[model samples]
Target: MFLKQIVHFSKKSIRLSYQFQTMSTFTSRTNIVTGNNEWIFVDNDNFDYQQELARSAFADMLHDHERNIQYEKAIIKTLQNLSKSMKKIHILDIGTGTGLLSMMAARALNQINNTSCSSRITACEVFQPMAKIAKKCIEKNDLSDCIRVIDKRSTELDLENDLQGDRINVIIAEVFDTELIGEGALRTFSEACKHLTIDNENLHIIPARATIYIQLVESSVLQEFHTLKNISQQNQRINIPNDCRHLAGNTIFDLNLNELKDSIRPLTKPIPIFHFNFKHINEMNNFTEEKILENIQCNYDGRIDAFIMWWNLDMDEQGEIQLGTIPVWCYDDQEKIKNIQWREHWIHGIYYPQESKIVKAKDQVSLYCFHDEYSLYFDVGTSPFPPRSFIPAILSRSAMAAFNSDKRRNKYIKVLEKSFSNSSIKRCLYFGDGLLLPLLILEIYPNIELIILQSSNTHLNHCLEAILLNSTIKLNYQIISSLDKNEIDFQTIDMILSEPFFTKSILPWDNLHYYYLIQKYRSYFRSNIKIFPQKARIRCLALEFNNLHKIRSPVKQCCQFDLTPFDEQIMKASLNVDETIEPQSLFEYSSKKPTLSSIIDLIEIDFEKNFYDKIEKKNLEILFIENGICNGIAFWIDYELNENIWLTTGIENENDSWINYSKQGVHLLPKPIYVQSGMKLQISTGFDFKQGQFLFDIIY
Candidate 1:
């Protein structure tokens, strides 16, 4: 019997050891070979690793002093009030990422020092990695004894075993997205109240209530994302399909509405639409579906293109300590607005109605605001419109904005018309993700044979085909998935053009894949094939971002509690997996160019020349003209259509503001460096053609 026990123990130990070995040995590998044909193979241990990191914008939330302070105040207030009555208090922190709130609760309880009242705080985190980190953070702050870190989600926690049968009197949670209930907050709260908490009238929720407010706006800038407009050229017109025109994209544009002040024209004053009381379990349970009809008086005479949505949190029970997500213009006290905390975690959301409405000043319009358990939708007029099926187009708002830009569309039109008129372009090849340029060219010269290199996205291909079928013009175009010599007569192709877009292109330079394609199919092309963008230039500028830097900044401490463990883990993960250069819509982020050098052209690639002909390296020196802290280096592409026609995906005008349409590449520095006037900075930049990646290093 002893021998049998020894053998069983040995087998168990071996199994456990094997499992650990397998986990430790697991690794991710990526190989990129850029030669005649660029090849990339990526095998990752976890496919969602990068996505998980990106979605968990913890640093951004932690850096939000306003949110932290408000939460801390609310927690402290709740504890103080609860301690007055209850002999023992139990606190439950739901979705406790990094254990910030749990630590706050522990500290709050400690501060109260109510000898009669004892407190037990339990923090539930679903993400195991984050849960472990939270435990470490709690320990680092010396709150391990006071707070219990549960690896399971709040719903998964057993009241008897996990909670030791302690009835939760106070529940603190921040399970909210840009849209108030989008993150399953209703279900979470309802389930907690039903299963996790004891049925008691004195039960308290930190955020006692929430109110959703919306303002009608007339924004031509936002209209492009929801509907496709007709394209007209030289008496010929390509009409958008009726279905496509009315298709209200299901996507909610969550952004900092303050930055889009120039784009949005307010049609109506902000009105409270939906109110949810978190403190009442019955209220949250009954909030499964709701439709509120509001008669809003329009203040401006314009078309109602969209509605801007924001929410206010009544953090404390008394409703005095409140947090609002309203934009700057909504506030009457401009001075108070300046002091209001800016947070990307809970920015305003824009919801497009199924169809836009035209309203005049003093006109009372009936707006129906509807919300289910997880999503919100709206309709204009007396009755709610019929639910419309989502039809995918260029779903990316940035891409839609780029295609809708009159200035950009005109540039492509002019260049295409001039090229067609000047040259004997019998056949043309379109080699980009965007269909606007190809459609425009076809509209101008229908007789010209066009071959479109089909994008990787199958949905986009289907949408393009539908548009083509709906067009009145007899179009001669073929969208081929690949450049097969047998399928496509490449030698007969006259010119290659693009909006220079690619689904795979995350950074601005990723669009350089257009040139890479040209090089790949150079052998099949005619000797003197014309390229629409004759050359491409990459430009760089040093910038000091206002609040954008906080996304990557570490949260060492929050509410006087040490959060270094969370910071260290995030920093390590970022160093290992995060991209050096990230793509950001710079228009949304306010940044100032350091008084260093003017925007410098880093490198220029001539489409006519072979990309792999030579290895490119550049070393440049820039001197600062004034003292400033440089946090980021912004880079953008300039496509030279001709000697006179140049299209920039960067700062277009002399005002130095980035064009709102396209996202530019920004390389955030590891840390902000303050530079004195006349300080020389050395920049070493290179393009690795073999790997199809750019390398940049700045040294002072």
Candidate 2:
């Protein structure tokens, strides 16, 4: 009865909660909207609760036992030291998402004073939904009497009303991002010290200090994401324009460097770049901007491509409790470091220099590191004091990676060369967002006429034009921004091809837009036309993740505090708006393949067939070969370029390894199911044409 009542209450609360929606506008004259007359409303509530809960990093951070225990130890030590000198103690937690840190302080105070009535603990969360959840969690842990929750930003707090005229002696916060200062940690600390706390010898901060470290490396793989590279087809070469070769965008690429061990070659040992003391407000104020020059000797003879950055935090005043984000290669005990807790919230940052530098062994190079209040940039040799403003690139980092993939480039070249070798093929049409595939076909047959169905991105089209003009070979091609019949002679087109990539594609199967396009425009093409990728298969496999599952897992307890209410809210939100399959870069995450079943083909699409004719429901069964917990099902698409050649956006080996360029689709189960050996499971899968998505249901 109690469980039923709780479920009923949760449903009621969900309905009462306000849903914030954004009103999109069509600014382009080409965009046409046909609908009834309606006035869209707007407000200050710009938050999307569904997206927040789906992509929340709270669960991932909480699952890190090392981080949680270190924080608890730091808080206990701080409170213990304060109890010796002060009669009254007040603590403030800024941006407390789940009240875990606030609860830790409350519990530690109770242990020190036998009763927490002598001390006050206040927590502020600007997000109302999270503030309510935090209050419920505090009540669940029976710490409501000691800890106070305020649903307001720290900058909006009133010292008299919110803090009750009690000057806070200690402040706790976790506002650091991958770049440490990118989330405005310095601003938050400066404001809290000025308005929320008292200036005294007893004033304390949880993370008293932070030190950043960087190491230069020469990696051709990393260089692909920073700038455009020249492409060669047969004896012809397509050169990148001078303006686009060295251009680097301002976006930071943050990922796990441990997975790319084979790709990166360290050119120099790690060196300290910058250090900031968070305990002192005056010191933080003085850190608005600074430039440091270090002379380092190179250990390897290679071109310096990029720098890898990570930081370590001194959590307590004594600096005994420390947490670092160093990669395995940096430590002597690599295996022990790998065994440590993995955290995605604080990963390594990969920063590219304005230009690549060639260094010899024992060569001394002058490294200049510059940092503003919230961002970091680097340079080599004696250039200007501060680096020049970053020039944005037309292609994103991911798009460049796809273009730089050697495997993909080789396959496409072979297929295109074979097709163009036939003199009978005169005209062709290319559809997709890839810039290189289209160029490769043009280079293979310079005299053949080609029409490109350009993507919605105007910048990509500009870059394509620039490259074509810069190349030595004269190419015959036309780019059509929209699918207009009058723009080209579609009936004369002999072949159609695609890289099967779309700007709006979010999942592996979303690229089925190619198939949909072929079906929709079948009347315009010739009856005997050729398709580069004749068919596609949707494949799936059962697997278990090491720590990726925690992103979607429910947190029942964290830091000795019950979080049932938080879990219930997340469940309700997920049911309403969360997608079953999400796109993830599987290469950065670790997973184990199940011993039960081999890969299964859930759906197959033949571009030559009609959509309705190929739609069918499938019901299959599989038996578990070994006992293990099934947590997720991974999916990828395999494109058959020819009778003997194939390409996949998933694992390419028997060892369950993935290609680093593309992201795969993953469906995490609501709850992990334990299966015994020889246990049978049923799977039902199909496609919903109306929604333009695939569906799957698994039963054990």
Q: Looking at candidate 1, what is the lDDT of residue 431?
A: 87
List lDDT for all candidates, in order: 0.77, 0.76
Model 2 C-alpha lDDT per residue in residues 375-400, reported as the tens digit of each score:
88777765454445656655556667
Whole-structure CA lDDT of model 1? 0.77
In candidate 2, position 100 carries an lDDT of 92
Candidate 1 segments whose C-alpha is farther than 4 A from its true place: 1-55, 233-236, 246-248, 281-287, 292-294, 388-394, 593-596
Decoy 1 TM-score against native: 0.91
Compared with the true structure, what per-residue lDDT tens digits does model 1 show for residues 1-700?
1111111111001111111323332222222213133222322334235435534654489988888889998988888888998898899999999899888898888899779898899999998878888999889988889998888978888989999888898899999999989888987888788777866477898898999888899988778766667777445556667664533356577888788887889988788888888755454445655564656789879999988999999999789899879888877897887787877788889888777888889999887777777777776776555664444444477777777778889998888778888678889899888867987877778888989989867877777888788877678988789889987878888888888887555677778878887888889988888888889888888777888888888888777878888878777767765677788888888866533446778888888987674668989876566678888888888999977689999975435668877888888887887878777678988787766777787865
Which candidate tops lDDT? 1
Q: Pick the candidate with the highest TM-score.
A: 1
**Against the true structure, what is each candidate's TM-score?**
0.91, 0.90
**Residue 454 displacement in candidate 2 (angstroms):** 2.0
Model 2 ranges with Cα > 4 A deviation: 1-47, 113-117, 233-236, 245-248, 281-287, 593-596, 612-615, 622-627, 676-678
How many clashes in each structure?
Answer: 0, 0
